[model samples]
Target chain A: MVLELARPRPIWQIMFSTHHTDVGLLYLVFSLLAMFVGGAMAIALRVELFAPGAQLIQDAMTYNRLFTAHGTTMIFLFLLPSAAAVGNYLVPIMVRYKDMAYPKLNAIAFWMIPPAAALVWLGMADFGWYANPPYSVISAPAPAAEMWIFGLKVLGVSSILSSINFVVTILKCKHPDLSLGKVPLLAWSFLTSSIIVLAAMPTFAAALLMLLTDRLGVSGFFNPAVGGDPIAYQHLFWFTFHPEVYVLVIPAIGMMYEIIPRFSRRPIFSHSSGVAAFIILALVSFASWAHHMFATGMSFTEKTVFMVGTLAAVPASAMHVFNFLATMWNGRIKFATPMMFAVGGIALFFAAGAGGVVNTAMPLDFITHDSYWVVGHFHLFVFGTIAFGTIGFVYYLFPYITGRMYNEKWGVVHFILAFVGACITFFTQHILGLFGMPRRIYDYPEIDAWISMNQLVSVGAMIILVGMVIFLGNMIYSMAKGKPANLEDPFGLGGKYYYPFAQRNPQHGEGGY
Target chain B: MAHSNWAEWIYLGVVTALLIYVGAEAWNVERIIDHAPADAEIIIVTGQQWFWTFEHEDGTKEVGELHLKKDHAYKFEVTSIDVNHDFNIPEFVVLMDAIPGRINTVWFSPNEAGEFEIQCREYCGLIHYNMRAKLYVEDV
Candidate 1:
């Protein structure tokens, strides 16, 4: 008697189900949507600042809400989730595990994001993403700030759960033969970043709770009028967020460790050093939080210690950069789309690192504090480095994930436009900041000397908008009609075989257990 | 992967030395605040949401602008009435937070006799962008 094979579930059921890859795909899709939402807000802000006479947004409340939403949506919804998305897709595969240790927990983590994001947009918090209080507590509209705080708390909880899953999965769920020492560098980075998330994110959650109580009039944790020290709030916030910068960048750096070697046709220059860099960055980042509080009244010794901490993290980053350049030294150097962005990311990281050093010098911080220079410095890291790495990975793995290849020429064009546009937008802001322009201001007087530079910044924003449109178009078209990846090792690196397609049944090998 | 390379050690050594140098320079720079003379002009600066109020020791109160004598050291005791703000004079390179219920001091001697910009470096509220004041370093 011939028995009919069990019918597989439909695509819709699978996508909505608790399967790890599908949940990861949902994370990617959600983050992509978040990027557009945040990007649109950014465009509106640039338009209003174009000639500085309140062009698009006339009301101060509207302008405040726009910038606040832009920052919150980007950091919380796009940047963090996108990093998690890459981790979700790659970590289990790299560790040779069938799925994350808790697939249902992963689904819950992804599901928490959408409603939290919705709550943020619904309220449109006007306090800056930093949400410095008593402004966030006493002055800014209550509904919006409270909603933002609630949203952040939920997101933080989701992050903690996700990090736990990652840590446990990496430590305990690897293939039997693979030793901890043999875990790939990308997996090591995820492990390190997850550990950081576990350690650092709870502090933010506690701070958010404190903020909620302060706003609710239940406690004066940050209200100076009631014997609370506002500086304590800054201490708490920066404590979590300073390490957060590493949380944002390290995974992207991990993706670089993966792509740079493959495209350069070399094994990673030094795997041990790369792993050391990740661990070192995590440790040094915690002590460097006070660098953000330089303007706050801290003792000279405190400032010096924080400055040392900030600078101490630099060596690890430098080692990573040195290793990357050395790996690409005299190699085949294929400029695939992924390769272009990886190389660009490392190159831009050098510039960002320089800006960071300048920011670290206690005396120099006086000049660049709260100025467009600081804005430019971070954008170099965020837009130029982190975003570059993430996009490159998407390109590198698109074929593997979708069984379709992205158009190579369009990918190159996308990178060029984004690079030029980002330079025009953020590089000028450094000059403008040096010229004494402060950040978070919605408008400036028309007769100010910054008129021309602001105009240039707006023009650059436009260019970025165009690039983004092309990117979105390219992604959608390619997903639907791009060529099938008929061959393994499509870039022809002749390197070790490490894509996830090897023996899809992950539990039991066809040849051996 | 476990084998340590000499190059890595050398790289770490150079970075450590450079960091120590920068840290030392930073320590020396802290003297900018310490070296203030006892007789320097004192300005008690109070910041609110959208404006700066400079209260000079000589009983002159100025709003939105400060007029100072060039090449004279000025001691600024900055505080905030409502929220956290940073009293920053970009040209003279002075920045310190103006926190409510607390006063922070920073000293700078303006060498350039020109109109410089003073701004609140910390994010306050909606009108934070417009929280600017002019610094006029007139001839002594």
Candidate 2:
């Protein structure tokens, strides 16, 4: 007389699954556009810094606005969302579903991007992103602050809709053959990312709403003049921003799960171990949010908890890379273009992620807090890993979606240049930060050595720009004129490896990749 | 054997280059390069309208050019007199978040002390540049 415990089922399920293919494509397209906008701001900032004194954006306030817009647009609007797009698109494919469990809801979620983007960006045309302050706002007849408020609200609404859809989908639509225990590796990351978005985005949405109301002269809290604590804004803001970083990387991990094994022509090294890593990260997201506040003079107890918890995440993450490389071991390796990007993505992820280890040192953070070094570390992880993973995902999966092959030579060309460009642009930043070059400075002093490192980084950025344009061209052209796909396993993995684990006993003829 | 060893050699070569670069940077141990000695300590508390408010802590209880002891340590506890502004001093390698409702503290024992400039790194308003304040560290 024993009772059986099982995964819970919901009252209703809808199966118009947003196939990972469509979501992945959307993610790539959106990120490319974001890269364009964020890069435009960076280029303007670079133009100002190219020589001492004024350039295209002359006012110091104007320069401040550009940097803010660049960071906000890239983080909130571009990269993390691109990762979400990856999750939305690929989860079903990994889970053996035809589409997302709730397709109509998925449509509702995807459809929300543009308007939300509009909300996040509405003030840019007429006013600087920070135009609504005690500082110099846009003198234009209309107040753009309201527009900004509206735009962010719209985007938040969309994020919430997507979260609801994803939660319902993963919980219900998994194949009967796949228990929660046996869910695909990508699905594990997808579910966790969805959970983070659900828990975190709401805080951001509520805060932005209060800001909107405050701007409108109605106190929705957070105004000390009206008895609201200003520090509260930071508390809420970082609550969202910290987990927001994880929101960026988790999807890339999912994409690597799909690509690495295929490129290596091997089955996954260990399924259960990878799932555990994903779960550990999901559970750890809450405790680590406070590391961003270590310099804000938070109490020693909170600081100690966050510091220990943050380092804990490092070990959990190590399990993932170990599993990935293990999957590649003893397997036939194809240095195909997509595989190269995946490999490069993992390498740079380590490089950037390794430096992030420094931030966990509270004393170190005290010295290098908010310096250009932090900037460098962030980009290395973000542009290096998340962005690279996305581009790699699009390249690897393009044929399946569009039924055409990319020119392998050009794909390789794009990958090498982009990887090299990322290294040049972001790697030098570590040196600049160590040299005491604080971030958000429109200009550095004559004797400051940051000049050379910055100049080199700019060159790297230019290379990345060129590589990106070429990759964009590759995507457009490949879809238009590349070879038509005729086989299920387009990667040409040998018969012994495709079906997983069959390589162990070769004579039975069950081996596949 | 040929292929497997080739990969290991490649890995070794890459690791060696990285180690060399790190060794060089560690040897460099680059430190702050500039020096200054100023006549006063001008405390900057950031505010937003959404712009920065640079004011004295005593609220009109103090006077001109931010007077201070020469060559001595003068503390600046950046309280966000108003909305958030991240006060960053590149010369001092100091950055503090002046959250609207809370206080952020950063201590800098200025070597060979002097006058330094501070600006808000966080975008607070159209006049973020105007959110600028002057700091003077004496050579005590």
Candidate 3:
């Protein structure tokens, strides 16, 4: 089997294959490609922001386009698809099924990403990721903004289809003896997030269409000039996205679940509570969407309601953090690269959650809204927490996917640089925001605080770029020439484990016992 | 397990109480900020593609600059002539959306006699970053 994976196959064969593993591999590769592309744009933006005025980017419009594309690419192209990649690889195997319930549909879902990504990259829309109107409708450049909408629409449909595949595969294709309660925690994470995608994605899909039509001058759904309310678009967009945040994070948490316990050489501390947290997090995510709109003149009663609604998520998220810490408490811990990333991710998760609490307070919203503080806060979640977990899981799965182990020393180096860089860049932005630097600005008035902090942020971004270079070099070099891994004990932790490939043949091992 | 359950409940209870306290305080702040004094002056602030226009109660219009007397309450009826912009006086934590076809209100009393900056907080267009104005507070 290792040889089979190591051997090169014709491009056409891999492209047309309906196997879940093949599709999963494709999703993983494509998501990594998107990550580097998006990360490049981020570095460009940060470099331009190194000074108060434009240094690398010539104009504000180009900066706008870069950040817009950076945001859209990272969220849709990298984060979501990467989670989907993990789901496709592990869900079927964990459920003791041979392939996804609808294998062709799974393939189709993976295939949709390339064209959607092309549209987003080619158009380079200047509107922000949310594409809020009437700016998106009235003032944004045409064809480019239109392409972004259609691109997102296609991506939305693709994810919906993928969610259906996951739901059916997990629920229907599980072996009869394997009860739903006993299904692996990672599978449960996929189930919860997939259900969320089904519920939350359609609102944004409809809003995107409305925005496109508004731009075409055929509809006035959110065009303030035509008796439409711009706030209505915000309401629709956040309604989908606030929950979409969980959709992006839950899978990473699931990856952590897989990593933390296995690396600690212990069973999960409380399996049931972890499942409960995922469900509660999903439900409460919907309640907090309106919190994003507090500055849009929501009434006192409305603002208070949303503020409390946002706070309601605290305990649920706390449960997961507690679960992880407790799981690692007295267990024999291996400080491997994967474990390091997982532990780092949890610590950052707390910081991100704390920032979120501050943002949710209605009074604090006035101070932080549309400021660099928001930029700092969400990136902590997306980059510090979610990306950390995803990248860690990629390292965890490296041995299984490529039949080779990543260079442990270089992997640790990459983690240290990336973690330190994230801390420097994001934490400084928080202070910068408090110092009155508004977000999405291509230039500032060269205040002392802004200038120094911008320089620090640019330096931090350069560190992360270097770390990413090391990471890519490690993956590519290790794949072709690294030492072969022990199939039974990959990390040299002696324990019984269920390997995905081994599950395909009962003679090799008990299938998902 | 029972002990852990107790700890979890206590943690959640404390969080809930803290959130309630903050919510109530935020509500009070909202009421205080949104409620202008009965004799407060009304300033109709209009935001366009790249500038701000402030019309005083007596129909005195000023573009790119606004003057208010210190220690006097003032209410701003903020709206946009073009797309959606945000009227933000960051130093004072005063912010409201300037949406076309809708007027949103925010009130602040200038306590200090000095000059400050006003900016558009939302992403409106190419020059959204440069969409700024000046505010002058005169001693009463």
Per-residue lDDT of candidate 1, residues A1-513 (tens digit): 000011233556545566566677778888889999999999999999888666999887898898899988988899889988888877888888878899999999988999999889999998888888888888989788888999999999998888999899899999899888778888898899889988998888998999999998999999998988888888889988989899899998999999988888877889888998999999998989989888887878888889888998999999999889878876898999999999989988988998898889988878898889998999899889998998898788677666567888888888988888888988899999888788888877665668999999889988888878888888888776788654457676665567555324222224311
Better by lDDT, candidate 3 or 1: 3
lDDT of 3 by residue, A1-513 (tens): 222255566777767887777788789899999999999999999988888776999999999999999999999999999999889889998898988999999999989989999999999999889898988998899899999999999999999999999999999999999999989889999999999999999999999999988999999999877899889999989999999999999999999999999999988888888999999999999999999888888887898888888988988899899889889988999989999999999999999998998898788888999999999999999999999999999998888777789999999999999999999999999988898788898988867888999899889889989999999999999988889888677899898885455534221233221
lDDT of 2 by residue, A302-327 (tens): 66667667766765576677777878
Model 2 residue A462 lDDT? 77
The C-alpha TM-scores of every prediction are 0.95, 0.80, 0.97
Task: Sort by DockQ, best first.
Answer: 3, 1, 2
* CAPRI tier for the interface of model 1: medium
DockQ-wise, the better of 1 and 3 is 3
User: Which one is best on lDDT?
Assistant: 3
Clash count in backbone of candidate 3:
0
Cα lDDT, model 1, residue A187: 84
Number of clashing pairs per prediction, in order: 0, 33, 0
Better of 2 and 3 by TM-score: 3
The candidate with the higher DockQ, 2 or 3, is 3
How accurate locally is residue B24 in candidate 3, as Cα lDDT from 0 to 100?
77
Provide the overall lDDT of each model, using Cα atoms, as 2-decimal numbers.
0.85, 0.64, 0.89
RMSD of 2: 9.3
